[model samples]
Target: MLKLFILLSKSKFGHPTVMFRLISRLMASNKPVLANTPVPVNKSKKRPAWSMYPKLHDKVLEKLKENQLNHTFNPKDEEHSALKTYDTNIMGRFRCYNDECSSPGWGSKVVAITIREFSGNRYNARVYHQRCRECEKVGRLIINKSSYVDRVTYRIKKWNGVNMERPKWEEYSGPPHDRKLCEGCRLGRCKKGKSDDE
Candidate 1:
């Protein structure tokens, strides 16, 4: 075995030096390389469970859809406090991250919105999307129900399916422009039509 090891080491079979060290260790130790060692535990910390998130998400979506039937309000309107806040804070505020467009990082425009009202006339807007005026890409925006007077403050939970900074409005940027994901752009006659050359 020692002669064979030496012969192998001097040949192309031992091209890798680590193999020689391992083989030498095996020969010198006179025992199995894996013997008696404790199995390693993957001590990765478990994330806190959001068990109710799915049900709550479905409920919110259902409520938003139901409210959409009668709760249509122009995002550009500033008469209603809730709608006004939505307009100023969310609509035409987010910057698009799409590089395909001629002007990436340009602020997006509100294309669709849904609102749900609560006690004391407080409102929560969900399923709202902002479309880039340049490339016509869409990004989802969510507004939380805080208080009637304080509803003006919004936290962006997600943008285009990504977790956002959640605090700063100016930091709110969106996913890459995708016309296919935008209904107005997909169906044609987007707020701003594509250039004639394309």
Candidate 2:
């Protein structure tokens, strides 16, 4: 039997049925291909990158500790003013979820916060959006928004007043990215113009 198996394996142009049987028998034996090879042990599951932002917030807060604002949070401020107030000075980490993009994320203050306004002069819901820095750097040729992926978990790393708390990884529970309201989305770089021939 051993001689027949070795002959079959050594045959250059062996029958398909004999080759298949030899391969199947080898796999079924459960013997290591290499001598004294270590068996692979199961590794501990790791936490997702997004889930670790609370700890990252600590490190990022150290960078943004001094850039505090005393101005009250307002929903009706002018768009530019609001963006400056909420996004300009702070540090934000964002991940890119676009297809074929391998960016883990980037840390920048390019966040856009929207405070929704309801009827009867009511204002609520702080919606946050962030752009992928890698995508922005790459610069796409077609007319498309700058890969503004959502659901960036944020925390009040430092609280100075009422109406806020040190929430643990508060995932953004707001509306989707609005291309019309996005400055990056409105830029000419993201748009394609018609040619004279057209």
Candidate 3:
């Protein structure tokens, strides 16, 4: 048997058939030979049971549908320019109605208004008021009307106690002329012509 093993090893039978024959012969001899090479055992970790598919709730599905409908109806509405400056909590800048204020106006960074319609053409709308930063410094106060829809006829009260119906402007009216800035320029927090350097 040793002579046969030595003869098989010396022969250059590199084909798979020769290897299979050698393995068959070894099995037939009834004497098992231990291989020096270690057999690789897979040590992969098992996934947790909680990682299975999740169950969806009816309310969640309804909410997702509503959101999809809203987005499909008016995609631009979600991309309102005001969102760039203010979030829900922070106030942003707007153009001052007072052309001579020489300072930037004050407004909410994000303006979210909701209008509800009822029977008989009656409607309820949410309005937001933004005061001019420069005007506030003086005794006078200027408040601008902001609405969800365009050209809304809303009542506004002036400093002189005069009530007037004004039309709301578009969400974006070109670029705001009175943009808030540092305390140096005419449109900043500082007084006109007075900077921190002086």
RMSD of each: 17.3, 16.6, 28.0
Which candidate number would show the highest lDDT if scored against the true structure? 1
Give the winner by TM-score: 1 or 3: 1
Tens-place lDDT digits, model 1, residues 1-198: 555455556654454443455466566867644433332222333321111112233343443343332222222322245422222222333444342334334444323233333333334443334454664555323223222112222221121133334443333346544455444344442333243217
User: Which pairs of residues collide in candidate 1?
Assistant: none
Which residue pairs collide, candidate 3?
Answer: 86-109, 92-108, 92-109
Give the 10-residue window scoring lowest on summed lDDT in candidate 3. Answer: 47-56
Q: Tell me the deviation in Å of residue 189 in model 2.
A: 18
Question: How much is 35 displaced in model 1, in angstroms?
Answer: 51
RMSD of 1: 17.3
Candidate 2 lDDT over 3-56, as tens digits, reads: 444565566425555355545655687764442333232243331211111223
Regarding TM-score, does 1 or 2 come out ahead? 2
TM-score ranking from best candidate downward: 2, 1, 3
For model 1, give the 10-residue run with minimal summed lDDT: 46-55
For candidate 2, the TM-score is 0.25
lDDT: the better of candidates 1 and 2: 1
